[model samples]
Target: MENTVDQNGLDEAIIVALGCNLSGAYTSREALLEAALEAFSSEGLAVVARSSWWTSAAWPDPAGPAYLNGVAVVQTSLDPAGTLAALHRIEARFGRARGELNASRTLDLDLIAHGRRVISDVVMAPHPRAHERLFVMGPLAEIAPDWRHPVSGETAAYLATAASIGRDARP
Candidate 1:
């Protein structure tokens, strides 16, 4: 469905995602962002804001190249489940492989938050640990600092601050 926005603000919530690990190739951050924008656009999603790519060293197994991560805000009508499904499809289209947890992937689309709805069942809303991950919060804060977690009652800035503390310590 086509999204609607009033003079006050957007009428629909925005779904955000990050595209990382580009097909085991040396893909630049801009390419990843472009692919994400194209994928979401094809699904009739509107991008309201996006952040520059932030490169980070590999983690855990460190089996692949460093990842270039970033965030994108898109307006959508799909519910959380539907949205996640769409994101998974997009990742598949980009050659994403679902292996071990934290394994290398072609794309990583995380739904940071959806308006004020706090859903937590099969698909948790606001990403259960979004606030605790610097890669997610750092980019999210750039676009939606004032956006608060419906359940935690904490702003993106607060979450980002808390997330930054142990980011470097991640192993």
Candidate 2:
């Protein structure tokens, strides 16, 4: 989240999913992640907690480089939109390109949740596709085992092991 806020906005906790397969302007995946965290911190988004990194096959079971994935919990005074904007900004700073769906990327930053707020604006919290991917659920479970999906009401732990593995697994 950014440091700005709405008149009615209060401090909120947010979950962010980070992943990288390709190296950006940064030298490597770790550097890209470090840069992203630095950017978040610069924006006043405090990283309260983060999951251990997990390696996973690229989506669609591609033969490309495996991606590093993790989850983070952040605290910020910024409203939902501001937080989302900050995330996009961070992604852009790392040279993320948007075009084809499911394309390989240098940095993928997804806002998984923003407190208990349910929003359906341009950015969707508690990402609709998050629960569908073991790569996401696996890391999310490591950091937020007790976290419940705002939409499906399933815990991250449950979703991580749901249907064993694979992106097509049911939660």
Candidate 3:
């Protein structure tokens, strides 16, 4: 199981969701995600556990390229905002351009949760809508099945099963 508590008795399960439909400079979405994982370590996020890649047709538009998604449990000393900044930097490094709400991109990295935090200002922890998306919850469940939502108190596995979005997401 992924470590839930660090030596300081603080929750260490920082969750990050990754997805890519456009490969950019990389030859494949899988390679893009792999490079993003490596980028995390340089930003001080230590990956403890990672889920196998999951695939699903693009949401709200199945005509778009299918996406490769996954989740990782990371340990980080940075606060939620810092972690978010790091994720954005990693995304930018991979040619991600923020414009449309759900436009296809070379890479997408979302800070799903920072331990059990529930921050609402600047950067929201326990991302406001992640619980409703199978692309996020399904991969999260694979790595941290027992992880409970800071607000809902529901397990990752339960949320994945009950997710209303990305219903076709699969590993």
lDDT of each: 0.66, 0.75, 0.87
TM per prediction = 0.81, 0.84, 0.93
Ranking by TM-score: 3, 2, 1
Q: What lDDT score is found at residue 140 in candidate 3?
A: 81
Better of 1 and 2 by TM-score: 2
- What is the C-alpha lDDT profile of model 2 across 18-92, one tens digit per residue? 988887777888778877886788877988777666777777756867787877788889887888889888888
Measured with C-alpha atoms, the lDDT of residue 52 in candidate 2 is: 67
| Model 3 per-residue lDDT tens digits across residues 22-136 | 9999889899899989899988888877888999999879999999999888878898999999999988988999999899999898998887788999998889999999999
**Sliding window of 10 residues with minimal summed lDDT for model 2:** 2-11
Flag regions of model 1 displaced more than 4 Å: 1-12, 23-29, 61-64, 164-171
lDDT of 2: 0.75
On residues 58-147, what C-alpha lDDT tens digit does candidate 1 reach at each position?
564456666667667777778778878888888777777888887767788888777777788867886777677666666666666666
**What TM-score, to 2 decimals, does candidate 1 have?**
0.81
Error of 2 at 79 (Å): 1.5
